[model samples]
Target: QAGTALLLLVAVVVAALPAPSLGWGVDGHLIICQIAQGRLSDAAAKAVNELLPSGAGGNLSSLCSWADRVRFRYHWSAPLHFIDVPDNVCSYSYDRDCKDEEGVKGRCVAGAINNYTSQLLTYGSSSLSPSSKSSDNLTEALLFLSHFMGDIHQPLHCGFASDRGGNTIDVHWYRRKTVLHHVWDVSIIQTAEKDYYDEGAGEFVDALNKNITGAWSDKVQEWEECAKNQTACPDKYGSESITAACDSAYKGVTEDSTLSDEYFGSRLPVVNLRLAQGGVRLAATLNRIFGQSKA
Candidate 1:
């Protein structure tokens, strides 16, 4: 009973403090989900609509950050939001980097993507209503999959373990003091929106949508393809993230580095590409999962 009380106290304290921005910041996740839902197949759109909570009103983007909000409540899920690779190693290995601190396998973002994708695949297969209450909590699975898709695309989410995905490396976003991880997760997107999109995330989404169908039309198919027709290709995404982390996210600077116009200018394009790819891949994964289901 004392232990339970202590745990509850800790939870209260943690909840009282401002939560660290994990995964992509709220807007980042929102942009990705918005882009994804717009590209969903007819069947996937229907399944997603049915699976979303009643309050969502068919807008998946509105709740794209739900997984992050539930971290304190779902303590075990905290690890599911990012991967930690060896410091100075510009690569990711599922067997090596996908474990939690206790060494449990399949606990990182990629594994979470695979797990939630599998869970959501059960939709429309049950004799009962696909959206009905179930042990797998398919609604939660849908939300998790949506959010993790965004997280796996943020390069620093796959950053070096020693720096805790750049969380430990102090940096400045223009003049404000922050961490490198936060810069990738939130600052870059926010700056892009402010500078070019009139501070509207919706406008940013519109620009990405234009690129998806316009400039990036040729690449979208390749981005969505999974080897051997796998339901989700998170391993590929993870690998891409680590490589981007090395080449772009962690390329320059050390502790106390100030990131300004030059840093933001170079990194914003990478951010845009990753966000676009995340949306396309998520829609592709969901389409594969629910495309054949009679909804």
Candidate 2:
């Protein structure tokens, strides 16, 4: 009787947990936000510091995953974390691809990015300064922007609808059984940290920062630039993600395919590149938005 009761308790606990993880893991979000906050302009930095919750201690990265944590409470936001395009489609279209399962327009990650970006833009406006009076919540906007920026960069976040961004595709990370989405979102980053960075994300961040300024220096400007001077360019980012998904993420293997050293080795560079671009573009967007805005 005790054994059966314990099994029931276990099932209850498992049922309560969030299923099918989305976006980058805690470490991935942290790394991206840390890199971004480091590159914030003086004006942007002041604004960010002013907006961050008191508990964050002026560290944006600390609250980078707040959106995910509140998904259950904010049920409407679940759809905003990802976009699902048709299976075997290698490209993304804003009008066609950026919508929720119910076919609501502007409900996907890219749209959410643009929406939150617009909300955060009101930060310095005199009429918008009083958070209590303003209809928009800049704090939540900042947190959502930071989190969704990381999400839209993850290749699988833009993966096929049939697979729920690879969430349904079961695969093995070496010897561990897990879904492909989790592989990209967490497993790969965790492996990199363990194998090369002394199990520290800070070291991994430092290494990527070095590449950003060193080998990847020439590409940084292109990554940060939005055509026609938009405050944020999520459409471009979404397009890049879907392309990368086809190129690197869903390139090979089938259901239950074992993603071992070969898969890990080749895909790690893609992961690094995406992470680098996410951080750089986030900082650039914030700089443009908060430029000359008094804190």
lDDT of each: 0.92, 0.92
lDDT by residue for model 1 (1-295), tens: 9999999999899779756767999999999999999998989999999999999999999999999999978999999999999999999999999989999999999999999988887887776665554479899999999999999999999989899999989999999999999999999999999899999999999999999999999999999999997899899999999999999998887999999999999999999999999988889999999985565
C-alpha-based local distance difference test score of model 1:
0.92
Best candidate per lDDT, number?
1
Candidate 2: misplaced stretches above 4 Å?
A: 1-18, 127-133, 292-295
Error of 1 at 119 (Å): 0.9
Q: What is the C-alpha RMSD of each candidate to the true structure, in Å?
A: 3.3, 3.2
Candidate 1, superposed: residue stretches over 4 Å from native:
1-16, 128-134
Return the TM-score for candidate 1, rounded to 2 decimals.
Answer: 0.93
Error of 1 at 208 (Å): 0.6
Q: Candidate 2, after superposition: displacement of residue 48 in Å?
A: 0.5
Give the per-residue Cα lDDT of candidate 2 at 1.
100
The clash number for model 2 is: 0
Q: Candidate 2 at 209: error in angstroms? A: 0.5
